[model samples]
Target chain A: MFLLPWFLGLVFITLGPVLVSLYLSFTRYNILKPPRWIGLDNYVELFIWDPQFWAAVRVTFFFVGWSVPLVLVMSLGIAVLLNRGLSFLPVYRSIFYIPSLIGGSVAIGLLWREVFGSSGIVNQFLQGFGIATRSWVATPETAPWTLVSLNVWTFGAAMVIFLAALRQIPTSLYEAASIDGASAWTRFRRITLPLLTPVIFFNLILQVIHSFQAFTQSFIVSNGTGGPAESTLLYTLYLYQRAFVQLDMGYASAMAWVLLIVIAVFTGLLFWSARFWVYYGDG
Target chain B: MGLAVLVSAMMAGTMVPPAAAQDLSGEIRFSWWGSTVRNAKAESIISMFEKANPGVKVSREPGEWGSYWDKLTVQSASGNQPCAITMQSRWLAQYADPSILQPLDDKVASGELDVTGIDSAVLDSGRGSDGNLYFIPHGVFYFTLFMNKTAIEDAGMELPPDDWTWDDYAQYARDLSDKLPEGSYAVGNQGGAMDTFTDWVQSHGETLFTPEGEVGFTKQTVVDYFDFWEALRKDGVTETADQMAEIPDNIIDDTLLANGKILIDARPANQVDGHQKVLDAAMPGQELVIHSYPVGPSGTGEDIGSNGLAIGATCDENGTKLTEAWINFFTENPDAAATYSSDNGVVSVDRFRTAQLENPDTTPGQYQAVNMLSTVGPRAKSAYFPSGGYSALSGALTSAYETVAFEQSSSADAADKLIAQVKRLVRD
Candidate 1:
C-alpha cells in the first residue's frame, strides 16, 4: 500500500507528461484549442521543409562539436594539474569551480554578452593593443565560437568529476611505470591516458547531451534575435521559439521528439563504442 | 471509535462548506514591469486604490521589462495569473486567446468603465480576432530620432532639413562619418534594419501585414530596403550589423553628445525623459535635439510607427472600472505623471498633463521630445497589432536583412527567400 502511492505518483507525475507530449506530437494542438489528430504532418514538415529546423540542427551539432572536445580537454588538463601537488590547492580549486556555479545563468549570459560585444571590455582592451575588434556576438563567424568558449570556461563541473576519477587511480600503477624507467610523459601516455579513458568518454557523452539542449545563453546573448544572421540559433532555442513565440505546439512537440531520438542515438553510439577504448578495472 | 470517526468526517465536511460560502475579501495581487520611477508611481496608485476599497490587501509584483512577458505568459498558461496585470500592446494579441484570458465586453457595455477618453482605435487594437480584449494599455509610445547637436555642428553640417529624403540622409551620414573621429560611426542603428525597414515600408504606403494577417510586401520592396542599408554599410557611414548587435541596452546612456560617437539614435518617445543622463555625459558644450525620422521616398511628411495604450478583453466589471480609473490617474495626474516621467525616460501620453512639457526643470532633450511628438502626433499612424502570421513574417524580414548585411546572401536572394518563407508560413 505504501509503495502503491509512490508508484502511482511516478506514473502520473513523471511519466504522464512524457506520454502526453508523445501523443501531442501526432496531433495538431494549439493550447487555446483542443487537440485534433494530425497524423505525421508536423514530423513531415520538420524533416522536409523547415529550414529553421535544419539550421538549428546544424548549429547544435556545431556547438557540440566545438564545445564538447574543448570542455573535455580543459577539464582533463585542470584535473591533472590539480591531482599534482600545488600551492593553495584548495583556494585554486574553489576559484576554478566558481564559474560552474554561475554558468548557464542569465547573469553569466549578460556578462558574456558584455565581454564579447563590440564596445565591450574585450574590445576596449584589444583597442589598447591597437587591434580593432568587431562585435563578437553579432558576426556569423565568431558567435558560435564565443558560445563554445563560454561552455569551455565553465569546465569546473567536469573537472571535479575528472578529479574524483583521477584520485581513484591506484598509486601502485604509477610506481610500476616508474620501475620500468618511464618518463612522466611516457607514463601519462601509457597509464594516465588509459585510466582516464572511461572518465573522458563519460564526460564527452554527458556534455554532448547537455550542449544539444542549450537555450538560455544563446537566447539572452542574442536578445532573442539569433543573429548576426542566425549563426547562433541552437536547436533548443528554435524549439522554444516554435513552442512559445510561434505558439505552434504541434510543431514544437515534433521537434522535442526528434531531439529525444537524437540524444538517444548519440548516447547509444557512445555506449556501443565504449568497448574500443573505455577499459574497466575488472576487465 | 466508530462514533468518533463519524464525528470527525462530519466536522471536515462542514469546514469546507463554510469556507466556500465565505465573502470574497482577501489579498489581491497586481503585477507590472517598469523602470524605478514607474514602479514607485504604480505603488502609490495601488495604495490609493487599496485605500479606496477597504478589506482588500494588494500585493505589488514588479520587475524589469525584458523578462516580464515570459513570466506573465507562463503564469497565464498555468491559470495563476495575477488579478490585474500591466501589459504591452505588442503581446496583447498572443495572450487574448480563449484559454488564457477572460472577456470584458459586458463590463464595457454596463458602463463600469469610462471609455470616453480612451481612443477607439486604441481600444480596437486591443481586441483579438475573436473580439475579446486581452489587456489595457498604460500609455502611448512612438519612435523618434534623437541627435547630438554638437556632433552635427562638428561635422560642419546643418541640422538635417525637415524634408530630407533618404539620399540626403545618406549624404549627411557620409559627411558626419568623415568629420567624426576615426573610431566613431555616424549613426548606431538600434533594433536592426527591420525596424527602419518597417517604418520605410509603411511610409512608402506599403503595409507589412495585410488586412487578413498575411505578409503584404513584394520581394522587390524588401530588396530595395536591404539595398539601402547595404549601400550605407558599404559607405562605412552606418555601424555594421555586427557593431549594432554589440550595443547593450545602456548604450543610450554611454554615448555622450560631446564625444560624438553616436550622432543619432532611434528610440521611443517615452524614453526621451532619460536623455538627462545623456545630457549629463555630453561634452561640456554640446547641444541635443529630438526629431522625427527623416521623410522617406514613400512616407508622406507624416510618421507611421508603433504607439502604445490599448485596452484588452480581460477586464471584468471591477477590472474595467479599476483600469479606466488607473489610466486616467496615470495620464491626468500632473504631479504624479511629471515626477514619474522626469525620473523615468518616458514622455507623458496625456497632453493635458503637460506640466513637465512647460516646466523649466525638464531637460532640453525632454523638451525636444515634447516638441517633436506634438508635431508628429496628429500625423502618427494607428499602430498595427501583428496577428497570427506576424512572427514568421518578422523572422523572414529579419533573416533577409541579416543575410544581406552579413553578405552571406545577395539582396535579391534574400528578398526571394523572405517572400517565399512568408508565402509558405502565412495562412490567411
Candidate 2:
C-alpha cells in the first residue's frame, strides 16, 4: 500500500512513455506530422544503412571505456587520501564533492568550453608562463578529451561514497595488520581494497551509466551542431540531432532503444564480473 | 423580479448588435522565438489584440532561438501545439503539410485575413510546395556582409563595392589582414556556411536543389566552392580554424567581428542594427556598413525569405477562428504592426514599412536597412531546402568546411563526402 504512489508513477509516467517510444521505434514518425507504422524499417535502416549509427557507437564506447576507469581509480585515490585523519575533514570533503554535486550541469559545461577554448583560461595560464598552447576545442583529436576531462573532474561524488565505506572498515583490521608487520601498501591491498569493493562496484556502475548518457558538456562544447567535423558527436548528442534537428523521431527512438540495450548489457557484464572482485565483510 | 430583469436584458440585446459584442471570443496561444526586445513587443501586441476584442485572451509564449524547436516538436506530436507558431521560410515547407498547419487562403477569401498590402510576390511565397497558403510572411531578410568601416580604414584599405568579384574579396581581405594588428583578422572562415555557398552557386546559375527536387550543383561546382576558402587560408586572408572555432555557434559576445578582431562577416540584413550596437558597445570607434554579397562572374549571389506565422492543427474550432482574427489583427492593422516595429523583422505591410521608415525614433542604420530590403523584397526567392533531412545537409556543409580548413584535407575529399552524405539522406 505504501508503494502505491511509486507504482502509479511507474505506470503513468515511466512505463507509459517507454512503451510509446518502443512503438515509435518501428514507425515513420517525424513529430511534426502523423506517425505511420512501417514495421522494423527504422531499426533495419539504422543498423544496415546509417554510417552515423556506427560512428556514434564507436565514439560512445571509447568515451565510456576510459571515463569509467578514470573516475573509479581517481575517486578511490582521493577518498583514501582524505581518510588519513586530516583536520578540517568535513570542509575538505564538501570542497571535493562540489564538482560532483554540480557535475553534468549546463553552467559547468559552458565553463568547460571557456577553459578549453583557444585564448581561454587554459591558454592564458599557459602563455602567462611563456608556454604555448593549442585550442583544445578546435583540434579534432583533442576536442573529445575536453569532454572526458569534464567527467573526470566530477569524481567527488564517488569519493564521498568511498569515504563512507572506508570509515566503516573496522580500523582493527589495519591495527592487526600493522602489528603483524604488514607494510602500509600491503594493508591497503589486503584490507582496504577488498573492504571497498562493494562501494567501488556501486560507483563504477553508476559512473558508467552516467558517462554513457552524458549530453550537456558535449553539447555546449560542440556548440549544438556537433561539428568541427562531428568529432565530438557523443551518442546522446547524435540522438538529439536526429530527433529534433532532423525531425526523425522514429529513427531517434530506435537509436534510444539501442543505447538502452547497450547500457543494460554493459551493466550486466559488470555484475557478472563482480562475483570475482567484490567482497563482503560477512562473507 | 428575475423575469423583469431578463425582459430588460432582452431589450438591451435588441439595442446592442450581437455580432460586434461577442464575435470571435476565445483564447489563443501564440508562440515565437525572439530576443527580449521581441518578447516585449510581442506581449504589447498581444494586449492590443486582447483589448480590441474584449472577450478574447491571447497568450504569449516566447523563447530564445535554440530550444524553440525542441519544445515545438513534442508539442506538435502530442497535439498540444499553440494556435499561432512563428516559422521560417526554410522551415515553412516542413510544417506546410495540411495535417500540420491550416492553409490561409480560405481566410483571405472570406476577408478574415487581408493580404492586399503585402506584395504579390511576397504573398505567393507563402504557398507551400502543394500550392496551398499555409504561412503568412510578415517581413523579409537577406544574407549580406556587415563590414567594419573603421577597421578597413585602419588597415588602409578601400571599402569593397557591391559589384566586387570573389577574387577581389580574397585579395582585399588579404591586403587588409597584412596591415592589421597581428592577432586581428579580415574575417572569420565562412566557406562552409550554407548561405554563403548558396549565394555562390546561384551566381553561377546553379543551385543547392533543382526545381525537380534533385541535387542542383555538380560535384565540381561544390568542390570549386571549397577550394575558394582553401585558397584564402593559404593566402592568410582568413582567420585560422582555431581562432574561428574559439567563438562557437556565433554567439554575439564571442564573435570576432563584435570584438573588432575581424573586419567583416555575412549577416542577415535585419540584424545590422544589433551588430552595429554590439560594435558600438565593444569597440567604440568602429562603425558598420551592410552591403550585398559579392557578385559572381555569372550571377548575383542573393536570396530572400521572411519570418512567417503558421496556424497549428491542434487548435479547437473556436481557437481556429480566433487564431485567424489574431493574425489578421496583427498583420493588417498599421497600429498593431508598429508595436513590433521590425524587431519581429521589417514590417510586412506597405503602410507599416513606410511608417517605420518615417518614424523619427528609427535609427539611420535600421531605416537604410529596411528601405533597401523593401526595394529588393519583390525579386527575392527563398532558397530551396528540402524537407525531412535538410538540416543534416546544412550540417554536412559546415562539416565539409571544417574538414577542408582544419584537417588540411583537400576540398575535393570533403566535397565527395558531403555529396555522398547528402545523397544518402535524400535517398530515403
Candidate with maximal lDDT: 2
Model 1 lDDT per residue over A1-283, tens place: 8799999999999899888999999987656556788899889988988777788889889999989999988999998999897889888888889898888999999999989987789899999999968888888889988888888898998999898898888899999889989999998888888988888888889898889888888998887767767888999888887777666677789999999999999999999999988977666
* Worst window of 10 by summed lDDT in candidate 2 chain B: B15-24
i-RMS values of the candidates, in order?
2.8, 2.2
lDDT of all the models against the reference?
0.69, 0.80
**Docking level of model 1:** acceptable
lDDT of 2 at B235: 68
TM-score of only chain B in every candidate structure: 0.79, 0.90
lDDT of 1 by residue, B1-428 (tens): 99999999999885552212322245645677777767877777666545544544567888787577767766766677666666555556667675566555664676533344444554555566677765444355567676777768877877888877867777887887888776677776532344566667777778776655656667777777778777877777777677655554354664432245677766666565466455646555666677667776666433333223223334355543444445444444444455565333333344532665778887766666656655665666643444335567677777667777887999889888887776656532
How do the residues A1-283 of candidate 2 rate in per-residue lDDT, one tens digit apiece? Answer: 9999999999999999999999999987776666799999888888887776776777777778888899899999999999999999999999999998787788998888878888689989999999978889877778888888889999999999999999999988899999999999999999999988999999999999999999988888888866576778899998998887777788899999999998999899999999999996677
lDDT of 1 at B312: 30
Per-model DockQ: 0.34, 0.50
